[model samples]
Target: MSDLLARHRAVMPNWLALYYQDPIEIVSGKGNRVVDAAGKSYLDFFAGILTNMIGYDVAEVREAVERQLATGVVHTSTVYLLRGQIELAEKIARLSGIPDAKVFFTNSGTEANETALLLATYARKSDQVLAMRQSYHGRSFGAISVTSNRSWKNNSLSPLNVHFLHGADRHLTQFKGLSDAGYIAACVDDLRHVLATAVAGDVAALIAEPIQGVGGFTMAPDGLFAAYQEVLAAEGILFISDEVQTGWGRTGSAFFGIQNHGVTPDMMTFAKGLGNGFAVGGVVARGDLMDAPHAVGLATFGGNPIAMAAANATLDFVLSHDLQANAARTGAIILDGLRAAAPRFPIVGDVRGKGLMFAIELVDPETGAPAPALAARYMEETRSLGLLAGKGGLYGHAMRMAPPLTLTEDEAREGLAILVTALENIS
Candidate 1:
């Protein structure tokens, strides 16, 4: 262990060391399982934050990548005719069923989000960005400026025009003045107020994760987004959905997270699950929006050959194998089991989210406050028992479960059993 640590410290950059990682050294992955250097296998319930939609070490993707490698070099400028990029763009467009839509690929979630912001700003010709409080939208400087995480900004960004709003705060807040319906109504009304009072040419776009991925997997109240869409459309504000975490069948649906809300965004960003663990991200814009002049937004790695091949394979696997429907089916069982388990545990406050992208929020039974410490402890205990879990929510009290869509029924049940054991031990 000392020798390995020495080797890592000697070769790796210190900036990466700033982040916390599990002590175990992962060597490889196969399907829904990953093996450490010591060869211990654990059910990957978190799926690398829900990026491995089709599971790890998928044969089709490996074969596709190998074929691409055999043909020629991986990276090439898209200024020329590129078969991989053209094929992926066509596949994504067909999967989305959108007309004359254009795709802009990038290297990661933040870059994809940054691209979307640029496109929206270019289209609307404004600076202000509206986002939901507690939402996670990547860490790019521009993306972080629009994101509501204060700690991430670190006061480095100047004059950020991010306006934060409550997402389902009507249900969470204890104020007696507003009913639940009225609370949701007020949230929408607040957006309307922002649009009305904010000076013209101030707000560029209203961006949100339709499912609020890291923000406790919170869903907007029914009809909330439809109502919000009306306000944004009337204000000439472009709607941007950051689906970097929720897109590509992880949410048990097709297309964007906004589809769940029954509204279409002017532009959408995607990263996780697009390449099934490969480094690929992209932005899909509406036809009219994409018609905006080029040269304003382009990436060297965007729509490159290797990344595009992986994405093409991932999309083929997802569609042909019905991974989205599988997620929906398996997710229902997990949600039911969790809801039943919640009643038995005093700390389990709520179980919510769409499909595999769900969470079990923990709270102190005595005070009804978020039990973040307890949740962290529970994660450690679960990992010790050979299950990998994730944390979410604003305060990080939510136990997030976003296993690979390829997870079998037995594997899911085993993971849930591990969770139940952890909850029992914590209690």
Candidate 2:
């Protein structure tokens, strides 16, 4: 191990995972690529875990931060009214698609989900929440409580009583063999059964990721959440869409992943790409839920001027460039290429995802069992070949790729070539 790695282990928590067997320190980045401390460049398909939406060192975001820095007043608690915060809030509210929507900023997606949970519980007067199985929220206690992935769930105790539901991972699920309509019907029936028999009281809310991020970019069939929404609404249960990984046009077909399901969530949490690598996240909801808590509440450094500026600039860049359309175009090419190559590689059990957020699930060729070791080997091979991808899933058998929305056809094809080569050389 390098000296920095040794020091990192000494100082940081052992649970914080890092990629690569010989982890390289990424010192700088430009466009879609990053340079390590050893000056090795890699095409950053992970994009800082999908946080750098527009790409590294984006000029607009940098200038926005610089302009805010010029003001010399970066940190202002939520007590004071700040122009940048107000402007950004207005932008988010308009784009949120909720009537009379209000926004509350946080420093990260975990905090955003935390705030959402508080609102859901307080509004509905219940501590019982429903979460999807094979889902990942965040690392914080409250976030982890709802997380269904065993590897990410560090503890069993939780403030809220969370019931795990099906429908997140279609391929690895019992609904795998069913047709699209059959799958949706079965999942809906299961949800109805859970609510009827299991939940003791009125359920507070149903929180779900439109696309399971840390669960390896797994997505449920279309209209699955819409089906759940109908059931939840009948029981007065709030719908909370955790858009941390699928928000801001990353999914291509829709501005928010939940939109693809054809239902408007009562509350939505966003982070990761919103600030373009800056620490910014927030919850957007109707006015009633926003004011549900009667007591005083505030996030000390949540809506700081610098973070708001970065987010506003990032949103502007995303819109002006029509990156959502770009994502749809480039993502289709990459997805088609991968699907075409999957037949040649028997280890690839599935190729799935929308837009730039895609994954390839590795499985044992003969038995069709989850092949996590093969996935790990493929990751290491890709790293050595100057490509960076992400891994996740309950079995750690899925290779995740979520490049910047600005990915060109050439870059997408290049990365695809490397990925194919990595798979070919896996044996």
Candidate 3:
């Protein structure tokens, strides 16, 4: 092991996962690429697990952060009035689409999800909830309780009695044979059955990811959540969209990933892409539900000045540049190319994506089972050839790719070529 990596292993927890067999020490980044400690520059397709939304070394965000730091008041906490916080709240609330929406800032997606669950259960007065299989919300105590995927969950004991619903995984699920309409009906039926038989009283909410990010970019039919929201509305159970990965036009189809489902959720939690590279996350909900809690809640570092400044600059850059449109147009090129080339790559089982978020599932040629080893090999090969990709899935066999929304057509083509070459070598 390298000296730094050895020191990291000595100090860090064993549970903290690292990518690649021998991890690359990233030193600096610019535009859509990053350079390692060894001076090897590479195209970053995954964008630091989709957090670096606009790309690296963005002058807009960097300058905003520098300007804020120059003032020297970095940590006033939530007790004081922070202008950056208020502006960001207003912007997010306006874009949230919920009528009379309010915002609560948190330090990360896990905290955002925890806040959503707190509001949900407090308003409904229930400790029960519904979640989808293969869905990954966050890593908080409450967030993990609602998360159904074993791959993402480390603890089985949960405070809330979470009812896991079947619907999300399309490639290897039992309902894989069903068409879109049939799949939706089946999943909705499962939701109904869970509500009727499993629970005794009210369910606080049904929290879900539009596209299960850490579960390997798996998603249900476009309208599956819309159908679930209908059933949930009847019983007054809230629907929370965990848009940490799918929000902020990352999906290419809409600003929020849930918009494609044709329904408005009662609450939405977001984090990953909003701050670009800085740490920012929050929950947006209707005013009434947001006001349900009588007790005071405080996130000590939730809306810190630096994070807010970074988020504001990133949001401004994204909107002013029309990055959403670019994501659609550029992402289409990558997805279409991958699908067309799939015919020649036999070990590749699937090529799926929406907007900039996409995945390629690796499987054994003979058995068609998940080949996580092959996926790891592919990542190493790609890294060796000046590209960086990410890995996830229920079985750790899916190569997750979420380049910056600001990726140029040329960048997309270059990254796509590197990916194809990697796949070819692996196959």
Q: Which tens-of-lDDT digit does each residue in 1-427 have in candidate 1?
A: 5578778889987544221245667789998999878888888988888888788899999999999999887888676677988888887666564567788788898888887887777777777788887777877678777666553554556334677777644445553367557766778878877767764665778888887766778777656777788888887888888888888777776555778778877788888888888898888888777778566445777888888889999988888888888888888778878888888888988888777888888999898788998888888888888887788777778888799888888887888788888889998
RMSD of each: 2.4, 1.0, 1.1
lDDT (C-alpha, whole model) for all candidates? 0.78, 0.91, 0.90
Q: Give per-residue CA lDDT, model 3, range 1-427, as digits (tens).
A: 4999999999999889998888888999999999999999999998999999999999999999999999998889999899999999999999989999999999899999999998999999999988888888788787888887787788798889898887776664677789999989988988998988999899999998888898889887799989998899999999999999999888888999999999889999999788998999999999999988998877799999999999999999989998999999899989999998988987998999898999999999998899999998998999999998999889999999999999999988998898899888988
Clashing pairs in 3: none
- At residue 77, give the lDDT of candidate 3: 94
- Ranked by lDDT from best down, the candidates are 2, 3, 1
Residue 55 miss distance in model 3 (angstroms): 0.7
What is the RMSD, in Å, between candidate 3 and the native fold over all Cα?
Answer: 1.1
* Model 3: per-residue Cα lDDT at residue 32: 92
lDDT of candidate 1 at residue 217, scale 0 to 100: 80
Off by over 4 Å in 2: none
lDDT of 3 at 146: 83
